[model samples]
Target: MRAYMQGGGFVVEVDPDEIEAFSSRWPCSNLTVTSGKEFLFSAENGDILDAATVSRGRRFSTEADDGSALAALADDACRFGAQALSLTDVLAIRFPDLAQAAPRP
Candidate 1:
């Protein structure tokens, strides 16, 4: 299963079972897993940690305006045999020259 975080700059791939397990561990704030199809994670202040969509063998897509926080959550999700890749990393690989052209500070 592949979960894509909209505007979060990363995606996590994990089995559907792992996604269910993760959702079970975290409570949803606004949505319910009626069909075991959606999951939402929010902070105490109401900021979203992650949001995901679950399917036959895939689950959850988390999104947040804060890229750093989203990345951290994605990292945590990886503990369940999930693999994550950042969009920045993909861009660097796809456009090496551009990636290396940035001025060093």
Candidate 2:
């Protein structure tokens, strides 16, 4: 599994099992999985700001693939009261084990 976000221009790939475990443990209400290819993270108003798309192997993409769509969405969401969270903060919250193991500057 992979999580991609343009906010930090990062793509984090982990085992599928780990992703499943995290999903089950946290169960984010704003996350939507569709057809096993797309994962959308929406704002409180249901506007998708971040997204991930699984391709072949451990590779994945994000809403940033469509030019500045991800940025536009993020901006719109923020305008409508969505608080911005950095990719690091998001990863730290969603994958505490991995985040803790990573080197920090």
Candidate 3:
């Protein structure tokens, strides 16, 4: 998985076949994207709260509109395996440039 900024919003690109490694069951969001697809979320404001792609499936995200908040959410996803990893975790290694921008805990 990889994430980057595009047109003021965040775009998450997920590979459809790789989701099984992260979760046994499909995500709750039920959002689907093409294999190696990119989903867009506006930075300014939008109705969508959370969104993710998993093997052509989907999941949730935070409702905050702040760009930094969104970046932090992505960071949390990247660190899914940190301590006690859960099935709901996104299980990404890290974001590209956004990883550097996200504040460390």
Best by TM-score: 3
Model 1, 1-105: lDDT tens digits are 454554433344444454456556555423233323332222111123445654565664543222443333344543211122323333344434444543333
- Candidate 3 residue 50 Cα shift, in angstroms, is 12
lDDT of 3 by residue, 1-105 (tens): 565545645555545444333323424333232333334544343213245433335444323222443344334433422212221212222333333434444
Against the true structure, candidate 1 reaches a TM-score of: 0.26
List the pairs of residues colliding in candidate 3: 16-55, 50-61
lDDT of each: 0.38, 0.38, 0.37
Give residue 43's lDDT in candidate 2 (0 to 100): 24
Model 3 clash count equals 2
- Model 2 C-alpha lDDT versus the unseen true structure: 0.38
Q: TM-score of each candidate?
A: 0.26, 0.26, 0.34
- The worst-scoring run of ten residues by lDDT in candidate 2 lies at 29-38
* Candidate 1 vs candidate 2, lDDT winner: 1
Best by lDDT: 1
State residue 9's C-alpha deviation in candidate 1, in Å: 12
